[model samples]
Target: MKFTKILAAIVTTAALFSTSVASHADALTDRAKSGKPIRIGFAHEIPWAYPGDKNEPLGFANAIAVGVLKSMGYTNIEPVVTDWGGLIPGLQADRFDIITGGMYITGKRCKNVAFAEPMGKFGNAFIVKKGNPLGIHTYKDIKDKDATMVTVAGYVNVDEALKEGVPENKIMQVPSNTEMLAAVRAGRADAGAGTYFDARNLSESAPNEIEPTDPASLPEWTNNWVAIAFKKEDQDFLKAYNAAQAKYLGTPEMLEAVGKFQYTKAQLPGDAKADWICANR
Candidate 1:
């Protein structure tokens, strides 16, 4: 009788634990449906995710995230800002529920977090001194000229540069786009490497000091897509998010949300899916 009672207690506890685990697995989905606030993590990168004049979250990625969440009835959103390097760690630490910083969906990052479908595509470009004094039009130019390039720390541009044969010592990692521009303007580096839109935005802000390489000159392999990130365990939330995204993406609403940030229909990812990008990239 004693043995049977012990076995029964153990089974009951095991079943309770399994039920709790299942409930937790779908907690984010349930929370969203209940109108609970979802935290969005973003890096302070222009045209991706940044603070607007009113200090509200604004950027192409943020707009997409907000639009999708709103469509899913998740109206309450809390923005958590961090440096680029901190985005993944912050999400893992539960500091935010989603990463909406226009992060690239790389094969390496795929192992860390689940990504929603890509929102858009972009290519690399260089921010060079006015007139591109050193003729630094491409990653190959940077390598051939032995030019020092600066990019944001933790950005995929850093890896792209290295992959293109730019020496590790020739590439400098900074904390933000502003710093990258400063490095180039101050002559600390010959060029600033970033997304085509980022380089264009920075160059336009300081037209006399820098100019962006024609994005078309970039090799096709340098092209990449950006997506929002969610914790790997939040499969339920990611599923609902992707479903909403399918309905929202490529719609006029999506275009209007990102149009102000210089994104156009040309930038849409089309048939690009997160799983394919992860597997292939």
Candidate 2:
């Protein structure tokens, strides 16, 4: 428990430290005119951002990032593989012009950096074992039935479960998504909560031992709008990205090329978790 608190504290401190750095008031325009290749930092989220063999980054977001930038006339875009926690800070430090991960457009996040129009939306939900030992059907099922939930450490999923009345102590926040899935399969946890697409991939990875629960039964007000993160003041990059995104939205050819890289269960639009990311969220 102490370790958990310490890790959370470190994350908070990292966020604060980054905020302090931005307070120096560096003009976002000084380096806005780089004619050089846009160096994009991307954290690998398999199936979403494919971490291919040798951990080469790939996937919808990776493809979209490269595709969008290339379409916007940047031919020398580079990919920087980073852990989930480090992706944002590296961007803040100017290590990359953009971190091509699927970032949600949330009010809290917008304060740090600008997010382009959502690249895609995702619904948040939990996955339970077949038969659902605790009959875990809803957020309330977790609360009233004394079920323990699993989540990636420091990820928003843990706090979302807490808001549903599941105690913080009842939630397990491991360091990575794989560990969270293992906990559920090994019976160390009753359920694992995450993005619906990711849950689908986990289930397909081990069909007999795991199964996804109905999203409708989970908390109602949850959605994730993934966008690329940029330096808060990088209005130029934001404009460039938005222009490219606008050009591709609703186009058949763009979607076809990008869809080829997604996981098997995620090939269809709004698969499994319907409505994708709720427009209202």
Candidate 1 Cα misplacement greater than 4 A, ranges: 1-24
Which digits, one per residue and each the tens of the lDDT, describe model 2 over residues 158-213?
65776778987888887667888899999999988887776777887889888887
Q: Measured by TM-score, how close is model 1 to the native structure?
A: 0.90
Model 2: pairs clashing at backbone N, Cα or C within 3 Å? 50-58, 103-227
Model 1: per-residue lDDT, tens digit, 1-281? 99999999999999999998867856567667677789999988888899877668899899999999999877899898999999999999988899999999999899999999998888878899999889988888999999999999988888788888999999999999999999999999999999988899999899998999988887887788899999898898899889999999889888988889888888889797898899876
Candidate 2: regions farther than 4 A off: 1-35, 54-56, 263-281
* Model 1 lDDT on a 0 to 1 scale: 0.90
Cα RMSD to the true fold for all candidates: 4.2, 14.5
Window of ten residues with lowest summed lDDT in model 1 = 25-34
Q: What does the lDDT read for residue 248 in candidate 1?
A: 96
